[model samples]
Target: MSAPISDISGEHKVYLRFLGKARHFLFNLRSFNLTPAEPIPAAATKAVEVSVALGCAVNGTAQPSDIAAAVKMASQADVALVFVGVDQAIGAEGHDRSHIGLPGVQSDLIKAVLAANPRTVLVISSNAPVAINWEQENVPAIVGGIFAGQEQGHAIADVLFGDYNPAGKITTTWYASVDDLPHFHDYDVRKGRTYMYYQGKPLYPFGHGLSYTTFEYANLEVTASALKPQKAVGIALSITNTGRIAGDEIVQFYVHVNGSKVQRPIKQLVDFARVHLEPGETKTVSFALGHDDQALKYWDEAQQDFVQEPGKIDILVGASSADIRLKGAVNLMV
Candidate 1:
């Protein structure tokens, strides 16, 4: 057995439950039949803490021997799963981290593992976005788990083994580096914050995720080209599963105010729909953009109320904010 299993029954209740509801499975890391030439240190094994709540206290540089042993194990294994993350010390309430890089020698660990095994999957568990540009360029697959609960082990295992196809997309724009961001004290979102106003090329754009299957987007139609500020419109599109396997696709609808008097988001997500499709199956996704929707209106500081600007509004639909597949325009009449 790779790990010991604990039975939870009436009288056999275990109290050392720091990681709540976490069940150790039998077919774990050891079950993969990895044989390292040298023994890996406890510090090396502690680097892969799947839970962000478990504070990563392992500090300073990684020992050469530990790294060498890990490399040996990775080279022998078919695939290596490198888990790295930040903890409460690095990311928590009221504590602002100066940079977004991985804490300690976690980056070193990832780079070493990737060098040893090209077929390495980088798994990150953190409270916020991390700049893993090197890994993004080299690592074949990356799984971001933002404090995924106690059952994250089973969930991650399922995805790794092809038992599950991940369709959930990241809600935040992952910057390429900390240098791309404005000062944390700059509360004004327009000063390069969030996906709405971020100007730099994101490492991973908002609503970015990959599935086992591929999807094709087409047939974008808007109900009205011109409408009054108070009127609503229906936006519809067809999405087809073009791959062999079944999966879920999130159709995102975005809008931008062209030539507005005041500042506006480059492109703002207005509506989204998640649909499951079998192989070769096609589905129609529709979004009702009404007058009251926040995306249709911008905060008018002078007027002290959210107001719809009278001008051309560009409509974009696709997988993500950066990967817009369909484009259409509308006019908001004065």
Candidate 2:
């Protein structure tokens, strides 16, 4: 590499500098030696390789093809795992994406492969959400590998082979399409941003994930029916693993103000807990939230401060924001 990589400076310069630093670090770690660039060695020898062919060029220009060879291969295979996603070139910290669909004809390739192989798994590796409404409806299974980094292959392999039970949930709302969103420059989240304010149904809501096993929520309890200012209350619930295998369940807690003078979010996440359970085993999870909890406070533009208004606060507990299973309420005294 040489100096003066770019005439630009500041953040863009910092983003560019990482390339040089990463090159050096990777070389030092013996991962690569690009100085005298040699063909990288294959990680495995026993793995069979197939060339189904991509449906597009690197520049995202679609090139539709017969894809007979790929379809034939998929039809004969026991199961087909179609990997598709965007790269840093398509999405990064410095810029915004133009659209959310699978780049070029990747979606087309997926559809063809899926038609031939019903036992198909759609594995997506991306930094952000992708619009795959068709895949969601038709694909047998889908795995979201959001920028899992270097060891992602091993992680995915373990989960696919049943050696690991994935319980990780999506952190953000995955909208069904780009049309479901407000303008990019709209800084006001109230206009429809995030799980808190978005009104439409999403492809996948926040905190959505499926475990290898199933669990049941029960015995929800709220310690206080009324709360004083700067005071806290305890919330508890019981969860039982009712399936054949052991797995983890993430219990989410959310709140909604029954009646407020000003506009408020539909629902807001307050706290969460994760528990591991064996088949037929049960565990109790609990959380604490004070009247002054930051999550319960709303910004007051006139006062230039955050405040918790006096009202009925509805408590919701469940697997995800959209999967509430228990309900309770408490009054915040004026």
Which predicted model would earn the best TM-score? 2
lDDT of 2 by residue, 1-334 (tens): 2243335322221111113234212112223221332334586456445345544542255534545556677888888888777766676666568998888777877888899989998888776789999999999899878867656767897888788888888999999999899988888888888999999999999999999999899998999989887688999999999999889999999999867877788889998888999999999999987878876778899999987788899899999889999999888875
* Model 2 score (lDDT): 0.79
lDDT of 1 at 171: 93
How does residue 272 of candidate 1 score in lDDT?
Answer: 91
* TM-score, per-candidate, Cα-based: 0.82, 0.83
Those runs of model 1 whose alpha carbons end farther than 4 Å from true positions after fitting are 1-61
Candidate 1: tens digits of C-alpha lDDT, residues 203-265: 999999889999999999999988665688899999999999999999999999899877889
Quantify all predictions' global Cα lDDT against the true fold: 0.78, 0.79
